[model samples]
Every structure is written in structure tokens, then in C-alpha cells.
Target: MNKKLLLICALISIAAAVGYYFSKGPERISVTQYKVAQGEVKASIANTRVGTVKACRRAYLAPAIGGNVAQLYVKEGDKVKSQQLLLKVWNDDLTAQLILHKAQIKANQATAKQFCEIAAGTERDSQRLSRLKKYDRIISEEQLDRAATKARADRAQCQAAQVAIEIARAKLEIVNTDIERTLVRAPFDGTVAEINAELGEYVTPSPPGIPTLPPIDLLDISCLYVSAPIDEVDAPQVKVGMSACVSLDAFAKKRCSGTVSRIAPYVLEKEKQARTVEVEVKLSDAKDLQELLPGYSADIEVLLASKEKALRVPTEAVLENNQVLLITADGVLEQRQFKPGLANWNFIEVLSGLKEGDALVLSVGREGVEPGAYVRVEE
Candidate 1:
């Protein structure tokens, strides 16, 4: 019985030695590890939301007067300069009114001339009054009185004809003005966005019921904007004149540069997250830019900030409550808790609980491993 007990003890000692050899004894990770270094780490919040690229100022071009669209000189995507003729209206009525007013003015001028001629002759005779010059001894007082009365009536008739001419001219001017307005011109330099009317199409005015006229819309794409409604929680960090980078799904490979131009004063409710405030971003290169539509699907990233030098560690290495397993000088694994700062998916800033020259673990799967646990460093 004594010899059997001795053999069993020897077997137990050999098994214990084998187990210790495999576990590598004193505390060390079975995987390769990197030394904690003091370096910079960035705290970034990325949003996977989409937005649109729009113009800073858009326009809706419409005709001043309503009429049948007699002709359209421009179409969609046509570039136009300020005061350039855009479309025309049927101006027959307005033209006719101008002609009639001109005729009336001519007639009134002729009548006024006739009355002036008659009045002049009478005034000349009155002025030459050699017989009436003999005080109280006129050759024919009745004749003199008739001459004076006729001259006065002629002068009055001439004045009335002059007034009639003025009225007719004013009427003609009004109609002429309307006729000139029939040719619609671009109020500014822009591109014709939509042709709401075609040739001979009876397009009505916006005021409604006035009459049918040329209809169209124009917009200026010289400068564009991307209005983003950033959440109120993130808005306070956003400021005017901050730089931004933008990408579009349509132009997936292209990148657009811009800056924050404005921010809304008040917050508004949004369904996806919480209340948000509107932000306007001004594109840097909008002049002569092509392929960017007024409303295009976009992905925007605003650079809030960056850190050049920060202490960083792999996020996977951190355990619960920001605890870290650090290898000690005595080759034992020690439990450590650190204060965490800004972090991304793979890395976090080590605010505390770690020092330079300390080794870090790749993962926290040390279930059987505890504080002061024996371990071996993997090659």
C-alpha cells in the first residue's frame, strides 16, 4: 500500500508540472502586446445621415403681364444674362391700343393747329385797331366787339385741343408701356429651370384670372448651399465659418468643399433623433460648376475638432468600467481602471490608470485570468 501511494504522488507531481509549463506560470498575456504610448487621440462623432445641395438664393421667374405665350426663346438648362429676353406674349391688343391713341393724338394736333391759325388772325387785326385808336370814336364798335369775342373763343378752342392731345398722348404712352412689357426679359443672370409654357400655349398669370401669358421659372446656380439641420445637442459645437467636407452618392468619388455660413437661432423637432437647428453651408467652388444639381443626395462631414497628441489605446483592450489589464514589473497581470476621454470605434484616449512603458492586452477574454494571475507572454 505504501509503494502504491508513492507512485500516485509522483504522478500527481508530474501532472502539476505539465499544467504549469503550458500556462507559462507567472502573469503574462498568451498573445503579443504593445506598450502604452503617449499619443494623440481624436473624439469624433460620425453621423450616417444624408442631405441635399441647394442654391444659396433661388428664384421663380414669371411674366409681369398675362397673355398667350406667343414664343419661348429659352428652355431648361439655358443660360441667360440679366435683361436678356426670355419669352414673348401675344401683344396684338396692346399694340392696337397704341396705334389708336396715336391716331387720336394726330387728330387733336390738327384741330389745335386750325384753332391757333384762326386765333392768330383775329389777334393781328385787334392789334392793328387804327380806327378803334380814336378814343370813343370807333368806325364800328359792333365789328370790333365781334372780332374780340371771336379771338377769345378761338384761343379757348385751341387750349382745349392742346389739352385733348395731352390726354391722348398719355393714353398712348400707357398702352405702349404694356406693349413693351410683353417681351419678358430675365430679371437676372440665371438658367431657365422649367418651361411652364410652350409656343402658342395659353399660360395664365400668377395673379389668376387676369389673362393668359408667358409662364416659366428660372433659377441661379452660381452659388449653392447645403442646408443641414444639425441636432441641438451637436449644434452648440458648430459655428459659422467652420470648414466642412461633403460627398454625394451620385458623385460618389467627388468631394466638395464648403464652410458653415449660418445657424438657426431656434431648435425644431425632428423624427429621427431630437430637435435640431438649421445650418447653411456655402460651397467654395460654385462658379461654373456642373453636375451638381439643385437637390442632390449628399453626405456631409463637419470637422468639429482634432487632437494632435493624446494618449490612446485599443478600445477592445479596455474592460468593463474602463478597466485595463496591465502586466506588472514582477510579471503578474494587474487589474487597472482608467479614465476614458474621446474615442472612436477601435481606440480610446487613456486619461488615467495607465502609464508609458506599460504593456497592453489585445482583448479582455481573460476569464480564468484574474489579478495577480500567472501568465506567459506569447512570442
Candidate 2:
């Protein structure tokens, strides 16, 4: 009986030892670790926006007067200079009228000359008759009066003919102006973007109720800009002349430098959405702008602040209340509070309680990882 009792006591002791070992838990937990490094850190506001490449000058060219398109001097993609003739409407009728009026002016001028000659002869006759009547009374008073009256009438006819010449000239000028209206000219140096009307197509004036196609679309692409919308929260920090980096999805690797040109004074609101402000960015380098075209989907990063050679860590490494789980040299976790300065989405600048080459605990939510917990760094 004593031997059996001693065997039971030994078995209980062995079971208790096993329970105590299991209560101690696993020796170490696998955790991801990050090394603190000195690098460049930037605080920026980034947003993806659909942007349109706009020219400094754009126009839809149309004629003031409606007529059949007589001639087209340019097509789409043609470069043009200011005042260059682009299109001409039919001006046959105006040309004919101008010619007729010019002929009338010449004819009227000849009639005026003939009337002036007649008036001069009559005036000479009137003067001689007055002198003869005064010297010898050979001419009757009635005859002298009749000569004077005929001279005056001839002079009036000459004046009327001269006025008629002026009227004809004025009519010719009006027709010439109408003919000029039939021709369309470029207002500025630009490229022809679209040609809505072809030669011989009738173009009507853009009236209130009538829809008419523009004869040509002109765009001056020498200077380009982008119109992008920014969130209202970040709009205050953005100001004119702020440097920005722009990238297009079409050119994935290429980036263009730009400056903030304009910021809207009012916020733009969408249906059940956050308010945004429109901003305009002007491309700075002309060389970099050569390959960029209008209407590209672009994303921009507006640099707000930056620090060079800043001691930084992955932003995820920092936990709530500005505390970071730092790993000691002995592979133990220590929750340490840090003062962070300039930070971005990827990195946070550690202002205090961290050093370059220090190992930082990155995985925060893993089980059995707490203060004073032993951790094994994952390779």
C-alpha cells in the first residue's frame, strides 16, 4: 500500500510539471522589423485628377457673314500665323457690285469734269456780257440777267455731279467691306484643331436659334497649362508659385515640373461629396513640355515641406499616441514614444527617441507581441 501511494504521488507531480511548462507559452514570436535610416522626407499633398491640357489661346473661327464656303486655305493640324487668311466665303455678288460701283464713280467723275468745263465757259460769257453792258449798254439788262442765271445753273450742275461721284465712291467702299467680311482670317498664331466646314459647304451665321458649325478650330499651344481640382482642406496650403510635380498615365515614367498658377477663390461642390477647389498649374520647362499633349489623365504631388537626411521610419511603424514599438538589441519589444516632424504617406520623420540604424518593430497587431515580449526578426 505505501509503494502504490508513492507511485500516485510521482504521477501527480509529473502532471503538475507538464501543466506549468504549457502555461509559459511559446518561446518567441516571429515579427517583421524595420531599420531606421536617414533619408529624404517630404510632406506633400497628392491627388489624382483628370486634367485637360489647355492652350493659352483657343478659338472657334467663324465668319461674320453667312455664305457658301468658297475656299479653304488650311486643314486640321495646319499651323497658321496671325492674320493669315484661313477661309473665304463666296463673294461673287459682292465683287460684281464693287466693280459696278467703281465704274459709276469713274463715270460720275467724267460727268463732273464735263459740267465744270461748261460752267467755266458760261461764267466767262457772263463776265464778258457784264463788261459790255457796263461799257456801251449794247446788251440789254434782261440779256445780262439771263447770262448770269445760266452760269449759276451750270455751276450747280457741276456741284451735283461731284456729289454723285462721292456717293458712288462711298457705295464702292461699302461693297468692299462686305467682300472682306466674306473672308475669314486667323486671329492669332495657332494650329488648326478642327475643320467643321469643307469647301463649298454653306455656312450660316450663328444666330440665336440656329446652330452653325465653326469653320475652323484654332489653338495656340506655345504655352500650356493644366487645370486640376484639389481638396478644399489642402487648398489653403496651396498658393501661387508653389512647385509641383506632374505625371501622366500615358507617360508613366516621365514627370513634368510645374508651378501653381491659380487657385480658385470659391470651393466647388459635388453631389454628396467633399468640396474641391480648382487649381491651375503651368508647365515650367518648355523642353519637358514637348511630348505632353492636351487632355491627359494626370496626378500631381505638391510639395508642402521637406527635410533632407531626416531620420525616418515607415509610417506604419508608428502606433497610436505617437508611440512606436522599438526592438531592443536583445530582441525584446519596447513601446517608445517619439516626436515626429515632417511626414508623408510612406515615411515619418523621427525627431526624438530614435536613431539611425535602430531596429523598429513594424508588425503591431500580431498575437503575443507586447511590451517586454521576445521576438524573432523575420528574414
| Highest lDDT model number | 2
Off by over 4 Å in 1: 1-49, 119-121, 130-136, 139-153, 180-182, 206-215, 252-257, 269-273, 286-291, 299-379
Which runs in model 2 stand beyond 4 Å of their true positions? 1-32, 115-166, 205-213, 254-256, 270-272, 316-323, 332-337, 362-374
In angstroms, the error of model 1 at 287 is: 8.8
Candidate 2 lDDT, 130-182, residue by residue in tens: 99987886789999999999999999999999999989988898998898899
Residue-by-residue lDDT tens digits, candidate 1, 8-53: 9999999999998978754344644667876666553333346678
In candidate 1, residue 44 scores what lDDT? 39
Clash count per candidate: 8, 0
Q: Of the candidates shown, which would achieve the greatest TM-score relative to the real structure? A: 2
